[model samples]
Target: MFNGIVDVCWIPFAGFISFLIILSAINKSVGVRKAYVNILLRIFEYGRASIESASKENTQSVRENVTSDQNASVQPVKDVDANESTNGATLITRDAVLLPQAQESGNDKPQTLKKEEFNFDFENCLDYVKSGVEAIIEDDVTSRFEAEELKSWNMLTRTNRHYEFISWKITLIWMFGFAVRYSILMPLRVLVCFIGVVWLTVCTAAVGNLKDGNKKRAIVNNVLGQCFGVLSSAISAVITYHNEDNRPSSGICVANHTSPIDVLVLMCDTNYSLIGQRHGGFLGVLQRALARASPHIWFERGEAKDRLIVAERLKQHVSDPNNPPILIFPEGTCINNTSVMQFKKGSFEVGGVIYPVAIKYDPRFGDAFWNSSKYSMMQYLYMMMTSWAIVCDVWYLPPMYRQDGESAIDFANRVKGVIAKQGGLVDLVWDGQLKRMKPKKEWKEIQQVEFANRLKSD
Candidate 1:
């Protein structure tokens, strides 16, 4: 009886895998993923409405109790005239302190400073307190490392708002979602991902045996793209590419990094030689497989001469026009897909056509960011598999070249600004590495110097 049940269950799983393979081979979708996303949106909408109604009722009850308590405990203050005096002291109205407007509205004038005794007032410290509070409310660096705040809960408990237990209706919906994600979706996704990786390894190994030529390169590119497509579908990735004409053919392709899947997303459409530190386990398998078929630069993590080796290899790769572009994320770390952070200048120093690609993931569907400090790779993949879907947009901007008299840092910032603007992301000057390390001593010193200068000026 158990054997018969297993056979029956395996039928649909095998059929699903076959369907995914067909989709990957054709490099097209029949709107199945789109339809799935629409269904998820409708479910989220229902949950949001149910949670809002419950919350409104709860808030109304609390407000009523608070209003009665305030009425019982408080007394009204006596009214006082703003301009009236008491005990020989005159009270000034706010209007009395107003200054007259300047007659020359179109012209600018410097204000004359009235020198007075410099007093150390607590009010000056209040500015610091306000800034501190603002930082606490929402900080640039820390918030970029956390999961994005959802306007409505996406039936996931891994968010700030806990609306799963808001109502019996929502609770039942959440339980159903949990069952679907854990019992059905995750296992299928894991199976598909495993098969995709195995397929990639086998195909790339066969392609690697071919003699070095254009034909071999062509075969490698096609195989890698198809394999990446299968892997992306494992997560139900719905990526829309913009400006396919600007897709990177050669030179270096630099993009803002949000997750390791960023490579998988882009590789589904175009093939690029990846460059990064070599790793072990799951990523190691993919890296080794990719390097066998293509000229990817994977260096040892703590090699003494890694930088020079990478620089030399990078120049040699770009010098050959026939070779694929080396994909790079010059930010050096992943960020929550809300902002573009300071990019490292090393990649920009290389003289070649720089292809800037912007990737923006719709967090409403699923958060694509990998907070490396908080979650391990396996844990993150688990979260991704259980999420509703991965929906994102990739914008390939026009190729850029370093202008005359522009430094590498300036060139990098220019590229970062363009990406941030195109993707509607906040352009931040803070380094992404701040997630892993403390701010540099020089950075703190610079702020200290600025504070001292302000004090002197005052």
Candidate 2:
């Protein structure tokens, strides 16, 4: 009975994988392939837009309510002035200084008015009125704009439901398909990857023993790394170069980080020296091996003193032409490919032209992101192996130079903006360390304060 059930499950799983392979082949041309992918991506885009619209509406509604409440609170003051005028009594200004209006008396001379001063919160009242008017105008404009956008996308929402249902069904089939594929291919893939790593380690160790110069060893290591990348099925890289001449021989290279495979993708293309925090577990072994083969910089991220030392070392490395270009992920941590976080200013402060690289992955076939916090290195590798393929796009943008009076922070932000724009990623103002823990409001405020202080000290 179990064998019969297993056979039944495998039938649809096998069929789905076959279907994907056929689709992939049909869309082989880059232009056709991108258009086809965009068709599938429309559903996700519409869903995201709807969510944003709803959020904006909610915020506007809250502002309107607050404005109304403030107006209600102020209405009584206006009523008091109206009542005084109707009764022909002394008019009291907001400051409580009474101004007596002239009244006809039996005598022609007007009676002297008593100078009674009342202390009303006139400044507070004016402030409330000004804020209420601004809020009302802003809320009305935003609400109208969001409503128009939502109306334009009405047809998309209707059409998206049909495709979304189909996507869900495909997703279910993909889950089963991957499970069966992993069962069959995981062991072999592991063995192949292990052998590849061991081969590189042995070759690197040999070079170190021979006392070859660092530059020579680094070039050889990079060639080997490319071979390993291909063996691991990182088969295709769609690169867009902004300025070919901007590829510097020795300077800092900053890139938006996505996955561990990023190292392989980059090393396959250029002989760049990497700088990162020390890793542990299986990855740590690879890091230690690579360190022997090249003069890469690695430091403990949590240590303030270690960071200062790293800054000095980076400056020294960039000064030497014999050294390869030093690569740094200035975001300090990997983020989901949808967004790029704030860039750390240490690399920007090195005071040289910096090259920015933008990387994006196509999730239509397989997701290339390695969520290291949730999955171990081995698990992530297995996942990658079981997927259909890993496809990526890398853009090497023009080198950016700091302006005459620009601070390092401003320079970093300018570079980050260009990279984010080219990469089709949202630019976020979040600190990468937010990934480690959920921050409370107090924590966020404290972090901002610390960042401000650090800037001042710099």
Best by lDDT: 1
Tens-digit lDDT string for candidate 2 (1-458): 99999999989976854443333323232353345445435644554455445556666676678778776442211111111211111122232111122222213432333344544444535543554565454432112111111112112222123322333444454445446446755544555556557766776676556555765756565545544543343222333334556665678888988778777767756667878778897778777777766678877867545656888888888887777788888887677666677788889888888988888776543556666677777777765776544567778888889999988877888999998899887665556655665544544344344333333321
Candidate 2 — what's its lDDT? 0.59
Residues 75-124, candidate 1: write the lDDT tens digits.
Answer: 43333322232211112212211112222222433343345555565554
Q: Report the error of model 2 at residue 181, Å.
A: 2.9
Worst 10 residues of 1 by lDDT: 88-97
Cα-based lDDT at residue 343, candidate 1: 87
RMSD (Cα, Å) of model 2: 18.4
> What TM value does model 2 have?
0.58
lDDT of each: 0.80, 0.59
Per-residue lDDT, model 2, residue 403, is: 95
After superposition on all C-alphas, the RMSD of every candidate to the true structure, in Å, is 10.9, 18.4
> On a 0 to 100 scale, what is the lDDT of residue 394 in model 2?
78
- Model 1 root mean square deviation, Cα atoms: 10.9
